[model samples]
Target: MNHWLTAPILIPLLGGILQVFMGYAPISLRRTLAIATTVLTLVSTIVLLVLASDDAYRLYAFGNWQPPFGIVLVLDRLAALMLVLTAVLALFCHLFAIGGTDEGNRQFHSLFLFQLLGLNIAFLTGDLFNLFVAFEVLLIASYGLLMHGGGRARTVPGLHYVVLNLVGSAVFLIAVGMIYSVTGTLNMADLAQKIPTVTGENLSIVKAGGMMLLVVFALKAALIPLCFWLPKAYARATAPVAALFAVMTKVGVYAILRVFMLIFGNDAGTLANLGMDWLFPLALITLTMGVIGALGADNLKTLVAWQVIISVGTLLAPIALGSTAGISAALFYLLSSTWTVGGLFLVADMVAQQRGSAKDKIVTAPRMRNRTFLSVLFLLGAVAAAGLPPLSGFFAKLLILQSAMAGPQMAWLWSVILIGGFFTLIAYSRAGSIVFWRTVDGHIEEPKPLGGNVSTAAGALIALSVVMVVLAGPISEYTDATAAQLQNPDGYLNILNTPMVGEDG
Candidate 1:
């Protein structure tokens, strides 16, 4: 087994436990530990990504047990990509939190690390049961983080989030049970091989289970109809926590890509391309709804939260294509949008603090102290979020458009995406004008200074969007390869079926 395959999960697990024991330590000490551990995990994931670039599968089997029976962590291009993304996002969020957000609760550092643990596991786990476990772990941690500041505003939404996820968890378990009963194994590779052979009543059960899993992932992804909780929950969360959550919806997208493509993919016989037909149309509706929500948002945080939904819709549309080009475009867009939206959340918080009584509300207030700085960051984030040109968002949308050119839904995809971008630009423009441009003549409250750590954290995330534009060539190449890797499950299944040398079965 390659020991590095376990580092992403273990590092966060150990870090959270150590911080728990250090509960009495200075906040500085805890913060330092959390950041250090996250940085280390980031390094490990980068190494794994480099290794995975060779397109080899590396599996870490628990207790040297073989596949289908042992719990395994699989290192592949996609998993490595997500691990790196999570670590990078977490590190910045951690940096931003130490600027005083962490002080809201003594257990903030611990919960944050636990959240990473769950996210990493969700990306790396090789079986369905463990994926369900990973969802529970992350959702539990999220419940705490959502209500970190503790107010009626957060409490109501947090309760809603909790109840909904609990329902999702139960559904997840039922789906897993159905799949297991029908196939006799919860290992994804085993299921992929077994699903194609299922027939009769068993086939129907498997199909129902697969669809249930889709509903669960849809809820997690915050797709329309099930996404009402996100705007409130995310809008109310502390700045750093909300920023970290920018990647949370992507977790659902990742699960859909991994499970659907690998197990229920085109090769799954009777169940081939299952749930995809529903995914594309709903994704478009989700996109439209998100744009409408953004237009109506009365606060910066709520607008950014709606942007998250828009991104999910944007991402799933391509993924629903179930083609290499479409999946590749989604992956590229995923990176750009996640980082951009996260930066926007932090920017919103900073703006809220400066605006005093007005908070993040989309109304005029006294001119902010660092008007030029915050405005610039917000503009960059807005342009990216709105998919404007000369930035990563524009390129990402271009890729999605290009991918859909030959598809039957070309006209629909083109129309919705174009219209969505136009409306997004209008929404951000309106918010920017009201908040930054239409300032009151007199000050309602004193302007607050932006902290160095806070500003740097936010700026760095936004800067990453610029970097994505510069590195578009290499990044596009990587995403293309990753998408190809996803399309070919034979490479994954063969590796899992064969035991590592010297391993005892």
Candidate 2:
């Protein structure tokens, strides 16, 4: 059963390697292989999620080595949730790629599988070094996918994306080295156990390292000033790739929640809430910037990209509160935003394709092929993204608001969120009307048929948002339990540091 913890990662990793050898295979075969791989990964993740929900935690040791002595993987409620989400998103996005996007590049399927491999590993890893390794693996795979279609649009933003992430990687290494030098361990569980014992100069060094790690994670999460690279990079990337990349930002959020809370949280005494004072103000600014950018976006893709930033900011605002309720709200919001925003990207692409010369631009030269269908999707995606009622986003935001009321900065957080939602709704209204209703010259061109593939893929994603609303009670309860486990890290640490059965003898 413990070994099952590794299946989500191993399946895609092995699948990717097999995909590489099939370079000469037809595109359909490659698509089938990729889809099959993701489906298996999703099934494995669902099983793991179920197990984790019952068990609270599962730990796997490689090569029979124990704890900090060798590599290990952890599947807790949070990690399992993320893994299941990624697998689900990957499956649908892969289907969308098969609709036509994967044909542009021979390596898309292999790279996609490898991307899943990295994401699953990142979620499962119990060590900082392995987390960094996972980040690089996924990032390298993303670079290839971002430019799969090969255009100056992608190439230009791709370079900026590459450079920024490389720099983030460098900082990550520096931070990891600092932690290892001071605490003598890269295993997160060991670091948490050891972090409290450090004193004087070493404590300072650890604090510095922890702050640096936060910066690196913030960079990944695209916290304001560090976020300019995301819009163009995401907007230019193909729809399926961009949709999957939606989870990439949450990787940073997960790291911040997992590592920061477990390692430097209330239990750490003098080191508790080290940089939290700064996290809130910055997150609010990020929320404001994201809303402004979305409001002014000239194209639907760009608006959706800014929505990603908005989602990140919104989730973090609650997290910065550093309470169990805050974390629980953040987790729920995280799930909702990722799905809604991802769906928006897919819908925007589909609608853009049907608009001919206008593409996704706000100026509508013609009615979309499936105006009614696409309009409904766009409406659903828009309402969800805007945090309107009857969708997960509404409940997610409401939860955040409820959680934030206990915080000192409650007013500031509330104002920004409400105002941001207002602008978001306005932005969606503007884009929706132009893209779906109004025409540039007051004359609409004949609409074409939206292919079944695009509609299905995009519709599935939007439908998931609706599902989230329906399942809010169960999902929120799960997240609440997950956050409780996170706030009290004893179970996780006990599982990590306790020697395995045969090893103890």
Candidate 3:
């Protein structure tokens, strides 16, 4: 039962290796192989998520090694949901890339699987060092993806993205070294047991290590001060690439939820406690700053990038409140953000193609008396992203608000969230009217020219939007269960100690 858990992590590694070696195949065939592999990985992840819906969290060890000594990979509700979501986004991005990419490149396809491999491992790993390695894998892959177009637009931001990630990697390494020095063991469960009991000098070291690690994660997660890289990076990348990158930053949020909430436990997260006090304040500021940035941005792609930042602000709610409701809200937000952002990028890609532009560098569309068909869908997606009611985003925001209203001192940030939401709505509406609405600006391209193939890749993206709406109910239920697991970390012991039988669960 437990061994099936490793399949999500292993499948991509093996597939990526095979793709990289078969370098001699035609570019089209190579892409077909990559999409096929991504689909297979997606199937495995969905199976794992469904199988674990009712099971206790479990971990599978390689070569039958015990924890506090050997490596461990965990499969709790949170990680399972993320794994399935990552696979789905990766598959869409792969398909979307086929048409949305004007460059017709195959290398992006090969490296993307490695990127998927890294992310799944990061979500699953039970040790600090292994997690850092997984991030490196993701970073290396992103650099290639970011620079795929081989022009000034991609090249300039590729440098910034790489440098920023390198800094993040450095901070992550320092934190890992500090944790290992203080605790003599790298396994998460072992650290969970040993950390709470430390006193005086050792306790100070633990707090410092936690803070440093959180700082590193904040940067990766695109929270507040460290989020400068997100807008420009995502804006320059292709639309599908940006959608996939949205999943990338959440990796940090996932780490915080799994490590700080579960492994570090209540003692580290309490308001009166100084251990992890920064999460709350940082989240509020991030939410506000991200919304302001989103509203102020003049272009659609940049606006969408800032929207991703806003989602990050929401993701921190659970960790900040240090309560069950907060955890639940955070899980719900993670699910909603992934869906909304994925849909926005997909529609944006089509909108970009229709306008005959990329990154909204220039909106070559003409204005009409009413909105275009694709423009209407684009606005709807953006509105959903901003948390309008009856949408997945609305339910997600409602859950977080509910959590904050019940918790201590959290009600204050409600104003900030609402203000951010307002600007977000205004921002998307403004962009909607400008690029997608009537071409009153005298810059509208020929109207009613939906004459392209519409591409199978682009269709895959539209499929994702449908998935978000259709899967919302079931996903929301699973999110509630995810929160429950984080609030109580007991099953984590079972995950790490449980023996495997048929497949990696």
Task: Give the clash count for model 1.
Answer: 0
Model 1 poorest 10 in a row by lDDT: 496-505
What ranges in model 2 sit over 4 Å off?
Answer: 440-449, 501-505
Report the poorest 10 consecutive residues by lDDT, candidate 3: 447-456
Task: Quote the lDDT for 341 in model 1.
Answer: 96
lDDT of 3 at 96: 69
lDDT of 3 by residue, 1-505 (tens): 3778788877888888887787777767777787788888899888888877885666677766766567877776777788988998788777767653624565667678888999999988888889999999988988888887778988888898899889889988888888788889778877777777777787777777878888888888998899988898898888767888989889988887777765577644321233456777788888888988887887777888888888898778546777677777777777767866876776665666555333353343544422356666675577678888666677778777877754355665677777788888988877876775435344445532332333444344444444656777786677777777777766675555564454464
Candidates in order have lDDT scores of 0.92, 0.89, 0.74
- lDDT of model 1 at residue 25? 91
The per-candidate count of clashes, in order, stands at 0, 0, 21
| TM-score comparison, 2 vs 3, better candidate | 2
Q: Name the candidate that leads on TM-score.
A: 1
lDDT of 2 at 159: 99
What global local distance difference test value does model 2 have? 0.89
What does candidate 1's lDDT look like per residue over 1-505, in tens digits?
A: 7999888889999999998899889888998898898899899889998989999988888887788888988888999899888899999999999898898577889899999999999999999999999999998999999989998999999999999999999999999999999999999988899999999999999999999999999999998789999999999999999999999999999999999999999999999989999999999999999999999999999999999999999999989987799999999999999999999999999999888889899998878778789899999999999999899999999999999856568888989999999999999999999999898788756567788999999999999989999999999999999999999999889756666659554
Q: Best candidate, lDDT-wise?
A: 1
